[model samples]
Target chain A: MNKLLRAGFSRLGRSCVFWLLTSFSAALAIFMCAVCFKNMNAHGDAVDAGQLMLNYSTLTGVVTAIFASIYIGVDYSDGTVRNKIASGHRRFDIYLSNLTVTTAAGLFSYVVFIITVAAVGIPLFGSIIMPLPRLFALLGCIFAAASAYSGIFTFITMSASSRTVSAALSLLCALALIMAALTCLGVLEQEKEILSGSVTDGESGEVEFVYSPNPRYPTESERKLYKTLLDINPAGQMLQLAGRAEPDFKLIPLCALSEFVAFTALGAFIFRRKDLR
Target chain B: MEYVLETNKLTKMYKHSAALSGLTMHVPKGSIYGFVGRNGAGKTTLIRIVCGLQSPTSGDYTLFGRSGGDRAIVRSRRRVGAVVETPSVYRDMTARENLRQQYRILGLPTFDGIDEILRLVGLEDTGKKKARNFSLGMRQRLGIAVALCGDPDLLLLDEPTNGLDPQGIVDIRELILRLNRERSTTVLVSSHILDELSKLATHYGFIDDGRIVREMSAEELDAECRKCARVEVTDAKALARTLDSMGIEYRILSDTTADVFAKINVSQLSSALSSSGCELLTVTERDESLESFYISLVGGGRHE
Candidate 1:
């Protein structure tokens, strides 16, 4: 297993996709920081350092999906995976090594994002107003979310028989998760009641506000389900990390860890049975 | 003889068809074993299963001394190298980098023999060019170079000469012969080109419909496909009678043709046939080729 990891990392080091994606991540983070700096100057308002730092999480899921799929997919497409297997490396080791490399890649990009946010963001925006404990907790959740993204995409790419199919499925899965999370956030953010404009009082001809129930408001059971959905999905966790709403730091990490383990196990199972040409 | 690989009743079934059904064969150590079969006759399937790329649905094989069901089979596989169907190479990497990657995978002590291996495969001069830019023959050689890593004892090459020009084919053949002679590497090469296989194989396994129709040594195949004298005459019966008086073994193929399995004196045969009033038309020496033998074994068609 260590040998497999060493080889995997060596390959990962030379991978053009890894370097390109890492550069892209850093560039995107810097661009976002500049945009925030410009906004701060125009509006004369302090930006939240934690929010800006975690902002990269919103796109990390998609980026990790692309990187993980293409990174692992090349092995199958180029038939290099046969070397490892024919060399007597265990299938589980190959799967885990790939998962570890991709997870590390995802975290590497996030680290760059954080570094960019600190270097450019601290001077432009004031220091993070969020408490240190809360900030650390959110950072851990984001890391876990990134790991989950890697695990899921690794599973898809490893189980898929072809490179193209794996890449397409992984990208589609990432997009689908984001859309589902957005729907959950939308439903969870509904107001119980809204002011439906003004009505004139019949006696004094005075204007009065009228209240009506928000039809989209979820029931108690629905709220719990939606909240759970937000806590479990990596994209949903990213939405919370980006300060769309308060995050369940404990539950999100726990769910993300479970996803990592479960996907790794399932992926190993499928890959072990796959017949290669 | 010690067999490096032995399969017993090995079977592999795809979704709706059996790729290998109770197929069994043996590859002797220090021998170039030719795996002969038509297309989709389970040549690659068997190779894949042996290389651990796929698994047998039933039955099992023993590699080195370890059974397929045993955990030690993994360790045994470490001594085996293979290029199945096509060369397995990283197109994005240079020849050296690809060898480095394989060395890393095998957990070799260091990149010690990488240069030597590249030189052996004739890729030492391909400095920094990626495998993607390599021509077909170059890529194939690189694949063999990668397989040569760790100095594997058993080398499995499935159709190693496919898609090669005449010169390319000769290069691969010489390489295989050199490896076998110098390193004593037991090779199992599956190919549709019987003529090429005949040039290198010390042993042969003919497969048809997923089962081995026959397995024999080169000497055994030679004996089976005997040398004969094809004789044409006015009447084969008359010629046979004259040849019978001479105590010669022969098979009459037609009224005017017979394959004599023994040496005959042309002058004596002509005089004897003339006395018997059976005119001798022609006498030509013939030897059955590997292709003809394979066709005879499995019945004939467009082989590939």
Candidate 2:
């Protein structure tokens, strides 16, 4: 296992995909910061460092999905996975080594994004408005969420035999998670009764607002389910971190940790039984 | 004789068909063992199972006298190296980089002998050239170089010269010979290219329908190969008629040539052909080829 991890990390260090994605992440942070800086200069708008820092969450999902898939899928496609197995490395060790490397890759991108955002955004927008401890805690949650994304995508890539299919599936899974999170957020954000429209009396030139119950609003039990889904889903947690709503800080990391463990176990189990050519 | 690898009724079943069914064979220590089989005859499947890339459905194999089911079998596998099907190479990386990666995986103390391994495979000067850009032969050599990283005792090469030019085939053959000669590495090479295998294999195991049909030393096979008199005549049809009336077994090579399995009087055959108004050309007696021997064993070439 140690040898596998060392080799995996060595490969990861020289991986073009990991470096390219990390650069893109950093460039994106710079771009976002520039846009915010331009807005502040042009319109005298306030910028929140916390929100900008949390923006890495949005990128983590897609980045981790693409990175993990390509990183792990190459083994199967190029037939290098056979080398590891034929060299007497256990299947579980191979799986876990991949997971570790991919998770580290995800974290690397996340850190680069954070550092880039802080280096540029702090000078332009000032320090985070939220307490330092609170920001750190949220950062930790986002890190956990990123690791969970690694776990999920690693499992998908490892289970798949073809690199092309695994990549497509992983990207699709990431998009689905994000869309599901947005849908949940939409449902949970609905008001019990909303202003539907304005009604004008026929006789008087006066307008009165009419209110109606939100048809899309969830029931009491349904609301709890959606909330729990939002808390558990990595993308949903990302949305929460990005200030879509207040995050259940304690539960988010707990769920992310559970997901990491579960997916790692399942992926290793599947890989152990998998037959390679 | 001590066997480096021994399988007892090893079986592997896929979803619809069995890839290996009650197959058994052995590779003796320090011998170049040829695994001869046609396509889909479970050659790669058995190699994959031995390499730990796939598990057998039933039965098991012993590597270096260790059972496949034992925990120490992993250690036993450390003495083995294989390049099954295509060469397992990281095409994106250069040959040296790929070797370094393999060395790390093997947990070698250092990348000390990579240059030597590369030189052994005739790839020492492939500097800065990624394996993707390499020719098929170079990539194959790189694959062998990677397999030679840890100085393994047993080497498994499956169709190593599948898509090679004549020169590439000779190079690989020479490299295998050198490895076996210098390091005393036991090699199990599976190929349908009987002529090439005949050149390298000291022992041969012929498999059919997921089972080994026969296993014999090269000396035994040489003794078993049939001898026949090859004859060329003016008219094969007339020669066939004369030979058929003589109650002799033969195979027609062409319109004017045939191999007679039975001994015949030269003058009698000549007079018989002359009586039929056909002239006998020439005759030479020689042993049949390994291809003919294989065809005689497996029944025929592939049927389209």
Candidate 3:
């Protein structure tokens, strides 16, 4: 197991893609911080720098997911998995090693992105603060999203033989989940009405008809379907945590934690028994 | 006298096709065992199964006296190296790095013997060049070097010279002989190149349709396939009598034809035949090459 870990690390260490993604995420976070600072100065008001930093961290989770999928998908496409099996490494070990590397890379990118956002945002937009529990919960959400994405992407990469097909399917599946979540939350219908120019201001011209959709008030069957979609969609849970107007974040972290464990177990189970060749 | 590998009714099926059906073979220790077969004869399948790359559908095998199902079998397999099909190598890694990766996989203490292994495979000067840039023959040599990582006593080479040039073939042939003769490594090499195999194999196993049709030691094969004088005689009884009186060994095919195993003085035999009232009609000396012998064993060549 130690040897397997070392081999995994060695491969990951030499991968130019891993470092490239990390640097890109850090640079993007810095850019996002600068944008938030510019907006705050234009408005002539103090900005919550930590909020912008957290937004960058949230984006890091999504980017890490994309990177993990591509990294693992390329190996499957090139038939390297077959060579690894032929070389006497157990199938489980190979899968685990790849998963570990991708997960670690994702987590590393998330950390760097978080640090860069915080470093630039706190000084430029004023000292933004968070309670200890809220900070821990936010970190939990980021880690959970990364872990779940790792599992889902690994499963996708192994199951599909072609990298293009895998990438397409991964993106399609992610979009489908987000679309389904928005429909369940009644957000899509409201957006559709707004886009079609049907939404209008009242007599006071206060934009009282501005729509906010929430599936929390759904029919029992729709609620059940929404719950099922939410259960599998890591991105849905992430958006729920990051985009909530109210700061109620405890359940989001707990949900993310459950997802992390469930997806990891599922990925490992399928990977161990898969015929690599 | 102990055999290094013994299989009892080993069988494997891929989907609806039977790749290896009841293949039972024994390879003795310290012998260059040639696994002879035509293409698609299950040579690679058998080697893959034994190397733990694939599972056999049924039956069992023992390596170094350890049964295939035993944990010790996997442990013993560590001492058995194989190059099945095309070489299994990372084309991006240099020869030295390739060996280093293998050593790491095997959990060797250090890369102390890597230089020696490279020299043994004639790849010592490959320097930092990756295997992808190597020629087919060079890749094959590096594959052998990967197999030699742990100094395995048993080496399984499947068609090692399959696509090499004549000189490259000779180099591999010489290397296999040197490995066997000097290091006493037991080799089980599979090849359709019967003549090349004949040069290296101390024992031969002829496989057809996934089963070993024949297995014989070199000396037994030699005697069975020895060249002899084939003569046609007018009188079989008289010819037999004359040969018996002269203390020669021969086999009479019919009243007209017989094979003379010993080299005979044609004039003396002619005089003997004349005294015995037998007429010698024709004399054709024939030696059976490995190709012809293999064809005879497996029926006419599949091509013919």
**What DockQ does every candidate get?**
0.75, 0.62, 0.29
Candidate with the greatest lDDT versus the true structure:
2
Best-to-worst lDDT order: 2, 1, 3
lDDT of each: 0.91, 0.91, 0.75
Worst 10 residues of 1 chain B by lDDT: B295-304
Q: How far in Å is the alpha carbon of A167 misplaced in model 3? A: 5.9
Point out the worst 10-residue segment of candidate 3 chain B by lDDT.
Answer: B295-304
Q: Candidate 2: RMSD over Cα atoms?
A: 6.9
**What TM-score does model 1 score on chain A?**
0.96
TM-score per candidate: 0.92, 0.89, 0.83
Candidate 1 lDDT over B1-304, as tens digits, reads 8999999999999988999999999999999999999999999999999889999999899999899888778899999999987789999999999999899899997999999988888899999999999999999999999999999999999899988999999999999999999999999999988889989999999998889999999988876678999999999999999989999988899999999988889999999999999999999999987778889999987555
How far is B253's C-alpha from truth in model 3 (Å)? Answer: 7.8
A142-208 in candidate 3: lDDT tens per residue? 6776677766766676567577887777676666656765564453122322322245456656543
For residues B29-60, what per-residue lDDT tens digits would candidate 2 score against the true structure?
99999999898889999999999988999999
Error of 3 at A198 (Å): 11
Q: What is the DockQ of candidate 3?
A: 0.29
Show where candidate 2 strays beyond 4 Å. Answer: A199-208, B226-286, B301-304
